[model samples]
Target: MSDKKRRQRLVQWPRVALTTGGVVLAAAATTFVVRTGDAASITADSGATPTRTVVAIPGPRTSTPPPAPVTVTVPGLPVETPVRVTPPGAAAAPLAQVQVNSAEIVYTVAGNQRPDDPVTITYADEAGALRTVENVSLPWRLTVIPTVPVNYVTASSNGSQLNCWITDAHGATVAASTDNTISATCNR
Candidate 1:
């Protein structure tokens, strides 16, 4: 070929590139339009899932108070006169169980040998296991306080069976008088 023909071909190179780019852009735009139109038709047709948006609005915030004693008395009840109903030998019997905090066992000397006197009742943790051990550090004869986490206890040192009254962290009796001696189940 001659130099003049070669130069003419080189000068038209930019035009060729522009034409190719324009065709590609046009094809892309046509494809987008076809897709959009098909979308509308599909929505109008049967068995097409509609555009659904899930809206979640949060619930109202309210401040709740910690659990404490609340005494509620109803109106119009029969007023009764004070009557002594002490049994023949009930008050004379020592306190079988008493509520306490944390995890510890203390005795108030029914005797130095008694496992539980003025029995301390507490749960193992928030997990609801009864404290049942005789934790006397130095054989306490009188007023004894032992700081040990005891499990559920059943029998006394005097070869007699004792009642188990397990209480929760709130000082409320959770389990009173279990049928079994080994385990104590607290109420929910």
Candidate 2:
């Protein structure tokens, strides 16, 4: 402890271990730039208390998404085609053949038929598939025909309280929700 004061404490212990390894490598590079740097802003003094980041600068990506005016639900019950779409060298919008036409039903029967009680007319189309009209006579006017727009029209009898109607061909009465009691359901 006397050879020049032990060589001046081994050169001041390597400058205090290289100044504590450069302050711990600058606090591990400021905690790796605050956990994987995007660095909107970061300041440090007393244990680093400077952070205000909200980096989400993304506003430029519409390669083709400004053309949306096509609403065509065709196959059944929805037919309104106006289709519009063009953005990417443009010019391509010509494909429409919406032909869905079929409507006729004058299934009327005005009461009182008891010749052994026989006046049955059960009809259901539009995929449910069932068409029938049996032993029709008296005050009846059957013509329940359709190509796809009539789901039902049933007229049963016990011989009293009978006033069924479903006319369309100027006899107008489009859909009164008669899914019961001398049933009739169209426009679906």
Candidate 3:
């Protein structure tokens, strides 16, 4: 290479380095100045107090006297007060008379009774016929009641015959019975 060309390249290297360093220094200084000025403005605005204005003044306070107490007396006959009873219609209705049809029975066997104990059965009287015996000849339905613990699984009806079986805790048959019109009690 020629001597002038080599000298020109060496001179350009220092200029390039100086330009990059200047750009980096300028960016850092600009960021520092912006952050410092923002912090100073925030601190000054937060600590500064508002100017006060003159307002009206009230007169001196005074204390007031307490009121006199009045005593009450009652003519008594007995130490214990007697309660007066009120009729039902004169007041609100009692909560016991309210009827709730929807209810679920939770069965749990404890103590000496086995979990799979046999259930007893009882019968409820069927509804009487509304019409006279000579006017209508309708078949009667029997209602069976199980006294012991049993869960009703399923009931099937075929013609005049109705078969039903109740199960205990161990899935054992507690009672099984079949009846036409007459109610029968079945126990395992």
Best by lDDT: 2
Q: What is the lDDT of residue 94 in candidate 1?
A: 48
TM-score of 2: 0.19
Which stretches of model 3 miss by more than 4 angstroms? 48-188
Report the Cα lDDT for residue 97, model 3: 73
lDDT of 2 by residue, 97-186 (tens): 543224655555455566677767666654447777776764555554566665456667656334455555434454433323333333
Off by over 4 Å in 2: 1-110, 125-128, 133-148, 151-164, 167-172, 175-188
Candidates in descending TM-score order: 3, 1, 2
User: Which pairs of residues collide in candidate 3?
Assistant: 122-145
Worst 10 residues of 2 by lDDT: 53-62
- Per-residue CA lDDT of model 3 for 1-188, tens digit only, reads 99999999999999999999999999999999999988867755674533233222211111222222232222221233333333111223566775422222211111121233332222221121221111111222222233433333222122223333332322233454544322223333
lDDT by candidate, in order shown: 0.39, 0.51, 0.35
